[model samples]
Target chain A: MPAKQTLTFPYSRRPALGRRRFLQGSAAVVAGLAAANCRQNLAGPPAGSGGSDGTLHIYTWANYTDDSLAAAFTELTGIPVVVDIFDSNEVMLTRLQAGGGDAYSIIYPSDYMVSEMIDLDLLTELDQSRITGLDNLKAQWQNPAYDPNNAHSVPFCWGTTGLLFNREATPGAPADWDFLWENQDELSRRITMLDDMRETLGATLKSLGYSYNSSDPEEIQAAYNRLLELRPHIAAFKTTGFENELLGGDLSVSMAYSSDAIALTLEDDRMEYIIPASGASLWTDTLAIPATAPNVDAAYQWINFMLDPEIASAAVERLFFATANQAAFDQLPADIQNNEDLYPSEAVLANSEGIVAVDTASTDLFDQLWTKVTSA
Target chain B: MTPAPSPPRPWADRFATRRWLGPVVLLGPAGVWLLLLLVLPTLLILEISLVPGLRLGQPSGGYGLGNYLQILQPVYLRVIGRSLAFAVGSTVLCLLMGFPVAYWLALMSPQRWRNLLLVGFILPLWTSSLLRAYAWAAILRPSGVLNTMLTTLGLPAQNWLNTPTAVFIGLTYSFLPYMVLILYASLEKLDTRLLEAAADLGATPSQGFWQVTVPQTLPGIAAGCLLVFISTLGDFVVPTLLGGASSMNISRLIYNQFLGPTRAWGFGSALSMVLILAVSLAIALLLRYGDKSSVSET
Candidate 1:
């Protein structure tokens, strides 16, 4: 969900901002290439001018903001905003951890990363009293798994990790995660999983009747071995770059986020996004202020700006992500509300697990196995 | 690098007494820039490499060789081995393909069109390397332009994208121009008289090329190969874009450590040091052989 941005061109297109920028070995250099286009979009006064000088710097996924969104916020608040995009939550977190994120007054991290930031004390505690429209949030987001009671982060966009396949290209419609393994011969070198480690590994874990956040070494090892079997058949691990191939029927299937997949299916009739019958990982990208945020006042204003139901609904209409704000959802057109992929049913939601920060040992295990899997 | 001797003047003679002053005045800005940007950052990475199990956003601990030692693990060794293989393979491919075109452009082709031909050869470099790799991706995918063309010609289609074969093609394509430019520079100065001299001495064309042409251009060949080797060795775009899952070389490995799921800065720094060392080793060889070959020829 953190990587829901279509603008990510993968260099797997820009880390989808970290890949080609590693020469410096510092997180600062990992600024997404999207910043080149984003620079011109920055409006009003110079950023980091301090003291509510009508400047707000936001670091977020590319899908979240458009020029109009920035213009709208500035029109209402009179604060010109600068938007910088990050492809992955890890890249976002790394930049902040490396002290390169002080300029950003606001950042959008995915659900699991919200919890991670909270644990690290990197995020400021949200001021519930100052924020209006807090009650408009859906019941689930009110006390979400990643950030309990929405204490530190605001739920912005939500989606699930699932297979997006070409109906004509695949031998059969994939009903679940196990479909790929079962149909390896037909799907060989034609399937692209997410470049994301957790989503792919977690999906595999769920297929084997294990939790998406399985921490047990044995369960993880089993998942690794299973992934190894499917790896040869896997064409590439990509988040943003597979769209053209999949649409062209060169790729049979791709593991993708609902936001990206939903957009594709809307344009191309051949593409279909499905949640695995076994289960899938549910992800929520959120808005949070870094503890070291320079402009607290403008940050609050921006959060409140997004919280407004009218603004929120408009974002959903244009951006195509499911609205977390119930007021916004109620205001959305009937067609959008009825879109099953955008808003999946309750039973499907119940089966899905939110990824969490696993213990260090488990993380190390995942990294080791992932390295070996890719290398071998 | 030698500084020019200044015209002796009354005011300048005082400062000129300090002989080291001339070099400092000449190299001061660039030297300071290199020290700050390159040398210092590399040393910092070196220091971080010595700290075992150092994760980002964590406090530093006592340093050890654990990170470097961890790189000795077979999994990492295979990655290093893969990177080396890609580098060596690309260098050879470039040399094989570049030498001929360079020979023609430098010596055999129409003299007036030589510069234009060289420009045309290097035109691909003007576009972003990322864009070039992406273009290759578009061309090499299963149903991409390459296969389309092959099928049109009544040839078997190839699905080289996302394979090691694709990586080699992409790397060779990206680096070939550099090889050509350097080889051309060397081949341009090929004293035709030497070839004539060899021919007059009962050497066949092949013998003349092997004995005189190659030896004369040995320095450029070494320099170009080293340049290609270094560039391909550190390349992140081609391998990541075209190499697919198996192309986890040292650069990608370092990328994964720093920006990937694991923020193992320590291990990433270790990998960086190793890559740096490998490139430095290439440069060292270039210095050793690039100069020595020219010297031996002269």
Candidate 2:
């Protein structure tokens, strides 16, 4: 008899979050487009009128904030912190652009988004003199490609994208991205890919021995065709909802971010995470102050609070984020320090690539191809 | 009175001409509201729909039919077709399931219990539709409650979740209460005297139901169906949550264009316009048929 389990995941309790994220994002964009003439008004007063309010308003990912973290900061400094969460980088950017996010003093953007925000002049340049623990970041992030010398953003957590599977249910260990296509029959209607267009399409590109950010039209077309072959066997394209299904044996496998997948692995022993042999995308979540921030001092204080080794280690233990700070890594337990999924070996590091914004033509091509894939 | 009429009252006489002020004051707030929030925004969407390849934060190009023409693509056309199928299928299902329950309650059920039963039917609507859709997900999954019961009964388990079947079930469940409410209103006013008169003339129950009952309630049917169809057509929640992969409907498609990794506002606006046009057409049908049926009944 098959073991039956309840379909309950922590995030599933708040099902409206996902739907609301999409709605608000789409609504903001529509409103923005309609009022394009008022774009200049959204720039949010000149940047120089920065003063510390009693509360520090932060805009970050959903799982990053907890009561204890905020309490710790408030205890250390007199300033209270009010946290708001966003589900995706695109949603955050859209909200910010629409001037709905002017109240936020700090924001958490991923690696690629840092560069995009820089291009859009949405970020404020960091003053090195104010921050204390810049030297604690791992060497890889010290002069990262997205923001050289940590000029505008501070690395908070870094991880890679990979496949999370139920070890007992899957036929065999998925050593690479090709495992999905190879076992499509046995895994029929029991697998889910990321809802993200870039991540899903990039995995296919890697499976075909091409770059994750391939701009070549022929290569892109080839990758699109390969994905179409596996589309029918796939159950859904979802970012967060797949966890409960996978846990209850309804889904055998899912593509997930390391932070989310790690939380589940800690809960259920049967789950396993593996980076594909060919390649996967490396991502880093960073803390930065938006240019329109009203409290620059509080924003710097929050970043420094996050960078402190003790606070970073505590966050890692409680939240399961892989910290980018070297000193924080030393403070972790041996088992966590040795966890390959969190800190993979150099060979695995060499195989991964960071996603970047492509040219306009390529972007349009990608949008067109993605529409075809989903519609088909 | 002729003497009091005095000299010719000017055309600008305050009290005589000011009679129009009462209506203007009454309708002013709603008229301004409709213009600012509804008409202006729709006009804005129409303007954006005319610009091709328009991305937010980027300079827009000259107006053209390029964005509208993109909808002619087979991929988008397929999405539109699937949306129509979901709407029409759920409307028919709601009519089938809701009519009998409504008829029993409106005409045959105990009068004291009528309100309670109707409230019970509508209780699900009080919760968030998002939560209801999630509940359906749990019930319809492979190892869910429905499949477990089926297996215990020695019946074949149906794999209905994440398929078009799930979409239909969810849509029908969401809109059935509205269908019942409208039909009950129409059926409550049902003339029982006509049925008695027909029976005395030797007309059978089935004949009376077909000839008298249906024609009298035809307007209600049209109104109920139009409401369900329009709501289902624009429903992004059910299809996004339950329809799973390969279930690309027009609302989700429009969402994707606007916020799903690609910011194609122009294309998204065009899709929105198409959706608006489809709904307008449904309302047109409702006005033409629904009014005529009621008029004939009167």
Candidate 3:
């Protein structure tokens, strides 16, 4: 099993050499990549695991794993943990596909990415008996579309993308996605949507009464056109750069993830987060073992460790993520439990849709349309 | 000749076989470096680019020119064109802004303060380019420093951020120092005697500058422009930060293809190849035309 999981380094063969020479060449390539800052932090686990030979490497979002969490796991199970952080699901998947995921046993990818990973046969099926806290997950998460019945991934956190605005700058509150369109005159060059192609286009699609994952060419093009109409009003397509402008009152509105918006809103009362009336893309970040994972036993142990309700609760509170574990949510402080941004009421969530993988042709069209929109 | 060689052929013939050693030693390391890093990667990219829509883990399909063909689409071509415009515009702007300052520093400024002036010009560059771009945002935004100053002066404030002009300004500002440094190096070597000769021959100062000084600094100008152009062509940060929602360029497009949702490594590689080719062409032109003295006068 571990043999199958070993990365097929892109440059595995050499015309001048045999198998041993090939391994050395590949090793050198990995070393060179590490030197170039491509995948250095991915090696989170210390060498000589258990003071011996087993190491469980986890690739996850930044701030997902801390030293205390690693120490706790090490102390509890005598199996050490090494965590490497990635900024985005796409980046994590890209590295995994590029064959840099050999040492990593566990990875965290967002909901849609989990579907893509499953399609690519990158994930290992989890044994339900081995996981202790499956029952503790909310009913909706247990049967999530991304990973039905928790077949391959464990849902860690879920959130929606919506508006993050400055209350002081905008005399009145922004109530929905249409608010930006309505105020395009005033908000011109003072509003930024997300940098994500799917989310930004999806938001436009949702506003126009289309599915976030619409495969229809007409619908996708319509979304693109709508975005182009608002192009002059948009300040920038930024991922994380809107913080200062929003705070400084230079920006009136920005589309943001609930996690980021919630974090920022907590810092200042003048900032407000709103889940649009129509809807937005709902995303979940999840953890799964890769099919190519070495040390299966360590991987199982790590999963079980994360499944403990107390540990899950701690992660939810400390990490500031919306917990999928119902038991953990019950344990959270009242203020956090009632945080509307994290756990919006069902009426608000009804309009939301999960982004799914589109067909190949549709995916290409989306890329082409996105290029046209941005480059226009 | 054979008769003469017959006397001491043993050690001489054996030792003479060592002459090829120097070239091999001199070029070996760099040859291997280029082969592994540059040549091999480019070949790999070519192979990947041939397989249209090839994601990393998926089995690669039969090869074709699909990826290259995709770039020919008007949308992508526009992106490439915009990137070229930005690069070329920035190069011209840098030359315009830098030449005068370089001229002053190298020719007119007091000798004792020359080094200090050059250091001051480069001080902002010593920090991260990202920081500088951010600083420009603060100064150029609608409610930013420039606008506030304009309003205070009862002048119409300019809405500059998130515009093409902002991108050009940022690119020019970011690359101006590199242009200045290169021009200064070339200009410092100016022949003052030649200028005096032209002036003595009844040429006015302007004519002297055009005839004597300008030609001398032509090489430096060419070198500076090429450097600025090549650097700006590859710059994603400044344009992405300063250019509004619609301002996608080749670098950002390439970035989206690679790291963005599409993950189309093939298309991304094709774009990369084009950028590399463009920069290579500019450098070739620079090498072909740049002269040591001609870089000083302007």
Candidate 4:
């Protein structure tokens, strides 16, 4: 019989090649691309893109930027600007903290996040001498409590969080937080609170006749208990997921930020938003340069560009967000000025408070209570 | 029957001394891989579990059992329990649906079409899992594809998305193919002569199936169950999207603890350890039972 042979042992070495080597090489290439992409994002605007100094990158909310505004800025100042949108203050803060946002010359952080960022030393103090049109802002925002004297941040936009509901779904528009509590029986599985802890918990605190920035542990616990009481009726704790349901008529009410509610109300007549009778958290999103910002000159220019009344007014009309620039507000169309959602009545304004970061003890208490509420 | 003829002397001489090297060479890379990615990360999580209240970017104070103790809190326990319920429910659901299809594919399907049917079953897995979850959302929502179809069929519309039932459905749908694939692999090797012999011995069709076919496929069933169970237990997406308000499973809680307002890395690490332990126990049970079933089948 002819000798029969079988391949055996170490498979003859065969140059030790495998498909995995190709995968490793491909992975290295992908990782290199990702790092370069991240670097471009973190190192400031791309080369030769803006005003001969490169485009200014402004990290902001989705509704804050419009194409025409960017196009106009490019035509006027020659400094092309790019906007990156984030859904929440915390997510933006996380990106900044993780060194992912060093490229941005400007970032929009809400009032309390501004305070937190300042404490963390992430923001650069503005050179007031170079900044133009500082006096064009609304009086309240001129020296806001969150960034007093405007030392670190410029109040770019201001709005209040409130209840947005489908008026056709229920008999009347939701007027207050207590309406949810009183009608928990009827509203079971039909409502959603913001996924945000501070906004949701703070609203609950305000509903129970407490301050939005209450530092008292007892008040925090009371708010926790109140939220627990309402959890059975709550369909979900969501920030952006409620939009589809609310628009589809499956959700009757959702706690929403004013910018989002205003846009939605404009889309449908049946949808309306109201500041609760007891009050809600008013938020001011501010533009500030990070300390690690690579292009300080570009940051200043971006700020001055936003402060321009024509630009700000056009943004307000296109974006549907209320602006902190008083000069711009004056230029807005009469219909926009009269829009109640953008500018609520004084009685509603009186009850609103800007969210502020409480002391560590209170924050801890809030965390504990949030856990219990969600777990239950 | 005569034992299979031994290999010729020259071939036997070559392999007899080198058989050990074959397994070692073939398995070394994967073993190293398992150690680095799986075993090392698990150990790191175990170490982190010992530190209490350890937030990321903060200096670690010391090592203790405080983080593990926190898991005993009623709130956290409820989350863990809910996770188990979802995983177990989905595993059973997948098994119930997967087994019959695997049986038909392996034992009954035409030989030429068998591979094609399997490719079809596996095609859904090629797309991103996130896209699948979103597709389920569109289909399961109140005014969604499923409800629209139901209304057209004169059936009542179902509101299943963002509910526990939705979570179960999503998980079962996501993992059913893996169960079927594993069972089919085991079942294709089944001996048909034994089944025919049982039937010839005056055994009824039902008895022949139970006594012959089932015993032959026990190993496949065990393997399929374990694969489905382990995958469902570690899943993070379905429970987050489909599990509406208050579906605070251990995985989501751990995520929130790290990334959300709390930023308690210690508690998150502790929860990670618990999840790792639960998955390990399931794997251990599978190895034992699955090995026994395979041996009995042989």
Highest lDDT scorer: 2
Global lDDT of each candidate: 0.82, 0.84, 0.79, 0.78
Model 2 alpha-carbon drift over 4 Å, by segment: A5-53, B1-20, B291-298
Off by over 4 Å in 4: A1-58, A66-83, A99-103, B1-48, B56-61, B148-157, B286-298
- For candidate 1 chain B, the 10 contiguous residues with the lowest summed lDDT are B289-298
DockQ of each: 0.32, 0.34, 0.27, 0.13
**Candidate 2: CAPRI quality band:** acceptable
A best-first ranking of the candidates according to their TM-score comes to 2, 1, 3, 4
Superposed by TM-score, candidate 2 places the C-alpha of residue A208 at a distance from the truth, in angstroms, of: 0.7
lDDT digits (tens) for residues B1-298 of candidate 4: 9899976798778787689788889999999988886788678778878988675445778999998888898888888888888888988998899988988999899999998999999999999676688678767776676776677689997878778889999999999988888778777788988888888888998998788888877867887787788888777777767776757787778766655666676787798888878988988888877734443443
Superposed by TM-score, candidate 3 places the C-alpha of residue A85 at a distance from the truth, in angstroms, of 3.3
TM-score for each model: 0.90, 0.91, 0.87, 0.83
**Ten residues in a row with the worst lDDT in model 2 chain B?**
B289-298
Residue A282 error for model 4, in Å? 0.6
Worst 10-residue stretch by lDDT in candidate 2 chain A? Answer: A32-41
Q: For candidate 3, write residues A216-256 as lDDT tens digits.
A: 99999999989999987888886665766676677889998
Q: For residues B44-116, what per-residue lDDT tens digits would candidate 3 score against the true structure?
A: 7777778887866667777888889988988788888889899999999899889999999999999999889
Question: Candidate 1 or 3, higher lDDT?
Answer: 1
lDDT for each residue of candidate 1 in B1-298, tens digit (9 for 90 to 100): 8999977697667766667688888899999988886888788889989998787666767899988888899988999999999999999999999999999999989989888999999999899887788788888887777776677689997878889899999999999988898888888778999999999999999999999999989888998898899999998888888988867888888877776776788888999999989999988998887734432332
Docking class of 4: incorrect
